[model samples]
Target: MRETSQLPAPGSGAFVFTAQEIRELDADLARRDLLELTMEHAGARVAEVIHARFPTGPVLALAGGGANGGDTFVAARHLHALGREVYVLAQGTRHELAGRMRRRLEGLCPIELLTEERLCAGLSKTRVVLDGLLGTGFVPPLREELTQWIRRINEAGKTVVSLDLPTGLPSDTAGDGSDAERVRADLTLALVGFKPGLLFSEVGEVQVLDLGVPPALLERHAHASCITPEEVRALLPRRVRGAHKGTAGRVYVLGGRPGYTGAPSLTAYGALRAGSGLVALYSRAELPRHPVESMAHRIEDWNALTALPRPDAVALGMGLGEDSVPVARRVLSWKVPVVLDADALQSELRGAGHDAVVWTPHPGEAARLLGIGTGDITRDPFAAARALQLAYGGTVVLKGGPSVIATPGALRVCLAGNPGMATGGSGDVLSGVIAALLGAGLSAPEAAIAGVYLHAAAGDRAYARLGYGLIASDIAHEVAPAWHVLHQASSEIL
Candidate 1:
């Protein structure tokens, strides 16, 4: 086990573990007689959560004959011991529960064995259905009976509380295009550490209960942050009294071809709004004739990049089209950090300064960079991201829901943001946000993670103002408000 003292603070993707990996860790725990102790601890923690949330029930636990089921049995015993009328709906049979679990249940309760018929029959009025039928164990496409059962429960709108992860959904993609058939729970009590599926997938609003996995044991394999408010606060530039605009950071936004100019202009504005000291735009066209001219204070020809004042960081390819590729090569041989988005990433991982580049790609752009199909990258993004990060020799922001920020050994998921962020031009704003934070003295990964979280949070705030009608500019507009809320609170709290 890696030392707990050495673990990165939670939000930096430093705690979530895979089911198989955790099972091995638990085996190591059991060889030392710690599995029962761990399960007991887990059950009690779950019980505490149920108590706090419920006022009354006909609580039905859908127990499979597995560790997750065992946890459900343990929870039932504790609740029944406290005089709560709780029942176990064994999805499997008594014969299936014949090992240690049968012995454990011997003195506990009259475990009413469950069937597909029983589950559907009773779930209509049950106060809560504890989804213990599957943990992070099953990947996708439940047995036909289970799929139909989920559809019925969803129709009835019954309250569901899943253990570990919802049943039926692949915790890591081994499904046949049916990701939607998984259990949809209202409350998921994630044990040990958070699993990637819970955050990256739309399971539900999640609550992580500490189950006494020794702090030392967890640091060994898991490296996912269940991002907290405090960690979100530490991302920024420290302002010195004598600091000038250039000294704080000079951010230059480039890349807007004949057909595409709004993208780079938006990128430049996003940098200024994120608090970069000075923002300059070097464009190929003159003001007014170019759509983004109002935002591009400075313009330069394609060959003028060499003579332009040195910028602390550069953002390239928001609007840099395929035709501009030749010009891009001639110009953007960057000395400082650069953000490579859109067309820039489609080129080889390294052209002039790949080591200093930050590649922000939607799955499509990412596929081009990896020389693989988008489906392959989408099915297993974790592996794809690690591959790309090593190939590019820089931080990789695999942007999407629960945006993945990975750099070699590290992989962090940003839990901030909302559904209102699916508008066009969102990526354009994101490229700029990352550049500004990078210029403002954040390391590439820090800037990427913080920039994604803040950008999403700003999108959410923008939605509050204008709902789904939100454009990219509205999100950029809310960046300051969101930053001030977190920054001032950060200055106050941490």
Candidate 2:
């Protein structure tokens, strides 16, 4: 396979549009021959994915009575032509498009009544399930029968693939508002646009399928986006033929107190592994066991720390404790790009130089920064990230399940990380990665985006190898592999 990023390029990713925006795009397309064309293309794409993934399987297609059902019927028709046994459980509507497709399926395959008894009867024989029960227009508090079917589908333990959005998740928002239940899929295939719910919620690995929507139409409407490895490949700095350490970038890490000596070392290690030529760790307390890859320096006082030669970028506040405030204040005057994390956010921040800083805060730290509750931040992460950026005047990374990266006019979310990365020291590693990228010549926003993406991608790779027992250092080690993968893709593309 060609080593391109998972998502296609131009922007290197799709613009995640809200449900209303998608509807507006649909209406505009419906004015032409585009709506039917989109449905045909969507069905073909879903069929192609299913064929490639589960080639010779007795498949079950759970379809609704609207356009979603029509898409399912199309896939079923394609599967039947491939000589696979395709069973469809469809309910309700006799809508025109759906009706036409169902008639086609009747001639080619089996169409069963969507009842609990029939569903349970078919579960044992089916290997894969396609969820097309609801589209983006679905609301919460699903019908009791539908809920029962969803529960049965879940209990079957079959690999479920959902089209568009999952059955019950709201297309516009990340949080499931009511106590309504939804289908939990092993793979969710989103068509046309990206939705925050699909990226943030329990819907498993998601891939944005091209519905053949014109790039011009997408460009006219899309704003928010997700970052891909190809974009990072294009953005990462390269080592020239005769490059030396001095030409490559210097990253300074300032943190680590009495008992927290490991934080600074991890920060320096992350920067070094992320491709910084020279990484130096300066700590208030002596860390005799600092990583051999980085040079260790002593910080007797604020004056000693600032007296050192200027670095291309600085990573601050890994474990400075209460001394973080003074250390961060001193560095603010240095006028270098800085990545502030952990206790560094505790420092009182103000003034014009805020634009040079990249703040990485968990919800609790974000709550502290905005003087709001953590609940509010989790309810709407995009808003919280934007608020933090506007308040601080730089890039803000709101670290959570699906970390949100916000700058002045842009927002991007990374969907690669897993629950294992919630361990301590991960944020410090992220800070170091951002600082290293900044030192290597990317702008503050670009560094934040690339850093967050690479950090998460590394965590994903580590998770695949070691599972949930992953510690912070494991992710740091994987950064090199992640960088290699991204760089390799770039080289092949060029």
Candidate 3:
């Protein structure tokens, strides 16, 4: 879409469209005689990905009787030409295929009619499975027959590569049904652009493949955007020559109780690592130990915040415990940008209408704020993030395996980080990272996007060295290197 020769990276910051929107775009392309060209591109890309990612083994293409089937037929032809063993199992008779699809099917030597025995036997022999059975047009409550085929595919233990999206996954809403209902893909080649349904965990590793669609056509239908490394790199603040601590921006972290001193300490270190000029931790009790570089202040009441040096941005509620509601209310009233996390999210700050505020909440906290079940939040994180942004009137970071960042007008999904980052104090570190970026002069959305990426990248770095044992402090420790790596890459690109 951007007129680049390279394939769209997984997190290319591309616009995400719904299934209906994709169909509309397809119609538009058809009107201009570009529909067939896109199909060819899609088929070629699928074959290429299968060839590159998988070893030299038989590939079974599970094709339906529609446009998706047509694509599969095209891919089968390409794979056959590439000298790879290919098998086709069509959902229906040859008569069901449309004209274009029929021509593509004719190019293949032998096509087997799909059946229970054929599907199971083909899966057992094949090293890879290409799921072109259903694309963006799939609806919920899969037919019993197709469901069984999907079950066999999942159980076959073959590397499943899906075209567009995994079969049976609704292209619009994140299906809240059981995992067995849909085809579980090991890799999904998202054609044209990402669909909202691809945000789920089941989609696996997604790589967007452009069908040479015009950017304007896609932008017209897209409702959300993916957060990319290039965008985060550009958004990161650059330090100038001879800059001092006062000029670098100050950040104040407010949280921590008797047992939860480590939470605020992590936040303070996170801020410092993220390039905060100076960081101060204000808690109810003076901690005996904290980050040596940060100042620790004991505040008896909300009024004490007035006596200290004003911060450019404030991080609230890492471990504020019971005082979160009152502290959040008081700090939110100030004009400075604030990042709300942990206990602060329990506050009744709905509709505060402060655009500078950033709310970072996990599923449980989001459920509390929205008065819904935690399952509901996890079921549709995109909707939950949007709801939180609408209710709190700021950027909302819905933290999960893959976090979603929502603003008043935009939605961004960050596909970084690992399962190792799921350890304790991770969100607190994120809160401080975002707070530091806000203080360093990025807009609320910019800071949230860049900060989220940086935090995830740091977690990945830590995970690489420490494996699953990496803690939140390890993430904070890697922030400097992560920032340096991003900065270096940004400089090279510029």
| Candidate maximizing TM-score | 3
Q: Report the lDDT tens digits of candidate 2 across residue range 1-494.
A: 11112223323367777777777788888887688778878887998898899887799998888888888888888887777788998886777777887787786787887999989988878999999998776776687898888888888999888888778777766655432478877777888877766655555666789888888887666647777677777788999999888778899999998899988888887898899999998887898767898988877786787568999999998888888877788888888999988998862774434677999999999999899998788767877898888888789999987789998888887756777788888888899899999989888899998899889889888888987789988899999998887888744452
Candidate 1, pairs of clashing residues: 10-225, 13-223, 13-224, 13-225, 14-223, 14-224, 15-224, 139-170
Clashes of 1: 8
**Cα distance off (Å), candidate 3, residue 338:** 0.7
lDDT score, candidate 2, position 32:
76
TM for every model, in the order presented, reads 0.87, 0.84, 0.91
**How far does residue 99 in candidate 2 sit from its true spot (Å)?**
5.4
Candidate 1 lDDT tens digits, 297-370: 44444656667667888888777666345544544555577888887776543545445567898888889888
The CA lDDT of each predicted structure is 0.70, 0.81, 0.83
Q: Whole-model lDDT for model 1 versus the true structure?
A: 0.70
Ordered list by lDDT, greatest first: 3, 2, 1
Report the lDDT of model 2 for residue 443.
Answer: 86
The number of the candidate with the highest lDDT is: 3
Candidate 1, position 69, lDDT: 83
- Which residue runs of candidate 3 sit more than 4 Å off their true CA positions? 1-11, 93-99, 173-179, 490-494
Which ranges of candidate 1 are over 4 A from the true structure?
1-14, 91-102, 139-157, 174-180, 226-228, 286-301, 323-332, 490-494
lDDT of model 3, residue 494: 25
Model 1, position 489, has a per-residue lDDT of 76
